[model samples]
Each structure stands twice: as C-alpha cells, then as structure tokens.
Target: MAFINGPVPEALDREVAATPAEFERDLRKAWPQGVRSDASLSLELNDGALRLTILLEPLEPRRIGLLTLPRLCARYRFEGGDERARTALLTRLDRAMQRGGG
Candidate 1:
C-alpha cells in the first residue's frame, strides 16, 4: 500500500530519544514507593523514542450488603513534546490510586 505521509514529525525526538531508562531511573526520585501493583505502567522504546502509558483498574463495587455501582477506568498516556505530559499522566494515575483508596 502506498503511504500518503511518513511518520510523525518527531515531537519528542531529542528529548526522549534516550528517555525510557531515564524515566525509570527518575521515577523513584519522584515516587519513593515505586510503582504500585494495582497500577500498570508500561514504557516503550520504539525507533529511539519513548512512550509511556498507565492503566488503573476501576474500583470494585462494595459487596457489604450495600448496592454500589462500578467505577470508571482511568488511563493516561504521555507522548510528544508537551511539557505537561508526564506530570499530567502521573497526576491522573495518582488520582485514580487515591480513588481506589491506595
């Protein structure tokens, strides 16, 4: 198949060309407890670039003889050169974790 255009214009090319390792190394500096088990964090190094995704499971409905509804799922991603990407991702995940009572 012919391609109309090529890949994205390296939004985070230089900044994250070698960021995956740096991210992992620096995560602990920010969160001393490391990543929690209920949270799923994945970092990918593709074509000399970095991308991060975090998924937090929804809260389970209470089963203590009280009617409860399912919670919403929370997922965040960090891509491109936006300065707030990482901060936003962490904030969302942290909020999710808090909602989960962790």
Candidate 2:
C-alpha cells in the first residue's frame, strides 16, 4: 500500500464510528460526481480518524461482468484539512490509488 505522511485528527477518530452519515456527507462534498458510482461504500477507523473507502465496479460496460478485474478501491482520512482542498485531493488520491493497484 502507498502511504501518505501526516497526522490524523483525534476528534475525527472519536466521531467517525457514530457519525458515519456526517462523515459521508463531508466525503460526498469532497468527491466528484463523475467518479461517484452505485457501488459499495464503507467507513474504516485507522490510526486516529475516520477513513472512507470505496469499491468501484468496472466502468466499461463490456468489462464489468465478463472481466474479473480488481475493484477500484480507495482509503482516505478526514483530518482537519481545508474542506475544499481535501475534497479535490481525495478525488485525485482516489483515482491514483485506483490506478495504482489500491
């Protein structure tokens, strides 16, 4: 796994378990509409905060069911970074992680 350098916010860590919807709301605002899909979405607590992970289905119609490719998965930490900035960062990171073998 590719590692990112930084500290996760403790408040987020404490709040994630019970505040999943709020966390997702923040994540959705940070994510891009084009990349968002009708796929599995989950929250994970790691280090000291809430992480968002997505399991993406194949975007290609032909390859979706026939080809058993890996799911486009990504993990993100919602630290106290700027909401706007982190949203863009999350989108880029998601794409990168998806292409970089999770």
Candidate 3:
C-alpha cells in the first residue's frame, strides 16, 4: 500500500543488436522456468500469480561501415506481479541479457 520498489511499468520495449537465437539463449539463462513459444517467437515466464511475456521481433540488421549487426525488438509485458517482484525479475533478465564492450 505504498511506493517501495520505485516505479514499475506494465510493459517495456527495447531494441537490441542481437539475433533471435542469441537473445533466446539469454532469456533461457535469465528465466530457465520460462516457456518458449516458437510460433510467436515469444517467451512466457509465469509463476501462477506472477506472469511475464517477452515478445521478440527481429528487424533488419544494422550496418555500420563494413559491419552488420543483428537487430531485435524485445517487448516485455508484466501481466501480474508486485513492484518488488517485477523489479527483481526484470533485473535478473536485464543482467543476463546485458553485454559489454563496444
């Protein structure tokens, strides 16, 4: 009944330079319990009361000079969860998907 875990969004969208397969691997690592839906290219992580659906949309590769990078659009939908729950879960996912170096 108070603002504790900061602000939580019902949905989040992010564009990353990674192929579907690559991102899927990270998704699995982040939430192994999550189920993958190949048909829709989405992942569903649910704990009955708390649910999160991740939609992966592949886009044209970005070319910089002679380099081409894979592109993907990731949409995260927080179906049911508290601020702390959502924040904690998202943090794990973000940490798993995070990449370093230029």
Highest-scoring model, lDDT: 3
- lDDT (Cα, tens digit) per residue for candidate 2, span 1-102: 233345332222111211334334544544434233342555432222323334322232233567643322233445544555445454454354332232
TM-score on alpha carbons, each prediction = 0.24, 0.25, 0.83
RMSD of each: 15.1, 13.3, 4.9
For each candidate, the alpha-carbon lDDT, in order, equals: 0.36, 0.37, 0.77
lDDT of 3 by residue, 1-102 (tens): 012246678887888888888887777877777665677788788865778888999999999999999998888888876877887777767776677766
Query: Which regions of candidate 2 deviate over 4 angstroms?
Result: 1-66, 94-102
In model 3, where do residues sit more than 4 Å from their true spots?
A: 1-6
In model 1, what are the clashing residue pairs, if there are any?
none
Total residue pair clashes for candidate 3: 0
Q: Would you list the rank order by TM-score, best first?
A: 3, 2, 1
How many collisions per candidate? 0, 0, 0
Score candidate 3 by TM-score against the native.
0.83
Sliding window of 10 residues with minimal summed lDDT for model 2? 9-18
| C-alpha lDDT (0 to 100) for residue 40 of candidate 3 | 74
Error of 2 at 100 (Å): 14
Q: How accurate is candidate 3 locally (lDDT)?
A: 0.77
Q: How does model 2 fare in lDDT?
A: 0.37
